[model samples]
Target: MNRRLFPLFAAALALTVAASPASAAAPADAYADEVVAYRAEKWQSAHFDDAEKAQKHAATLKKLGCEVKTGAHGGHTDVSHRCPEWREISLKTHEKAHQWEDWLKANGFETRHAH
Candidate 1:
């Protein structure tokens, strides 16, 4: 590593990072589109108190473009909003509840299963 080459190496690295896809941010419209797609179908986030209900709900969610797994998060159906892993929508705190409600309504969903 010559002293003169050090600056060139750094510049190359910066260029590489700038061109990398991971360095780019996902567009907000993309998230909004996915939310709209999720809302276009019947989306229900509820507790899987019954195994049968959980299975049915998972299947329904899968049909609506979700990648569902075979389990619950603390007795609730873990529905992955986008990624492959499942997420619990049941642990809604006071502020989280309002945010969830607002998000649902904004995405054209009713949040009908917030019991």
Candidate 2:
């Protein structure tokens, strides 16, 4: 390579690397962000009286583009879902979870805090 062209070659290489697909991909915290959103939504702390109800709730969350996991916790069913793409949705879900938890408690269903 000509010494006179070295700077130009370096600049081109830098631009190519900066614009590469790998560089443009989501940050390493992409999944972590989802988790954070899920927690902020309070979906992970929701409690149900039975597995069936928990599964149903999980299904509803799934329809909203969240991945849910339901299981028994402290003798009650717990439901948790992954983050949605929008923060607004997460906030909405959080409010919904609060209402659901309150209703469950009122209905004589035991509830537990998230782990």
Candidate 3:
């Protein structure tokens, strides 16, 4: 291959990868808004090998409404904060949703289709 064409080919490959949808998504958007099961948030890292340091981290987490617990670490105890993860709420079936809509109308609440 010609040296000039080699550079152009590499540039095209790079552009292709960058333009892909997967590469375009941001970190927070990685977890889609799709409905999913309810699960506890996994323990996030505090970078502490000492229980005392971890306790301090846990204190901060607790202040922000996280439930924390400590587990066995190699040299000490590992503290991890358990935060609640948001679960998308949706009525799966249109029949059930319509039932609720009817009930809402009977109760004097206005309900309509999403469209």
Q: Best-fitting candidate, measured by TM-score? A: 2
Candidate 3 pairs with clashing backbones: none
Worst 10 residues of 2 by lDDT: 30-39
The alpha-carbon lDDT assigned to residue 40 of candidate 1 equals 26
Q: What are the per-residue Cα lDDT tens digits for candidate 1 across 18-115? A: 11111234232221211111132343344445676556544534443454556566765543333222222322234433444454344334343232
Q: What overall lDDT goes with each candidate model?
A: 0.36, 0.39, 0.38
Please, what are the lDDT tens digits per residue for candidate 3 over residues 1-115? 1222323323332332111112223222232222212223565444455566556545533433456776765776665555444322123345533443443233222334331
Model 1, residue 71: C-alpha shift (Å)? 1.7
Q: lDDT winner among the candidates?
A: 2
**Over 4 Å off in model 3, which ranges?**
1-40, 45-47, 85-115
lDDT (tens digit, per residue) of candidate 2 on 1-46: 1223323323332332111112234332221211111212334446
Weakest ten-residue segment in model 3 by summed lDDT: 15-24
TM-score of each: 0.29, 0.36, 0.33
lDDT of 3 at 22: 20
Q: Judge candidate 2 at residue 86 and give its lDDT.
A: 36
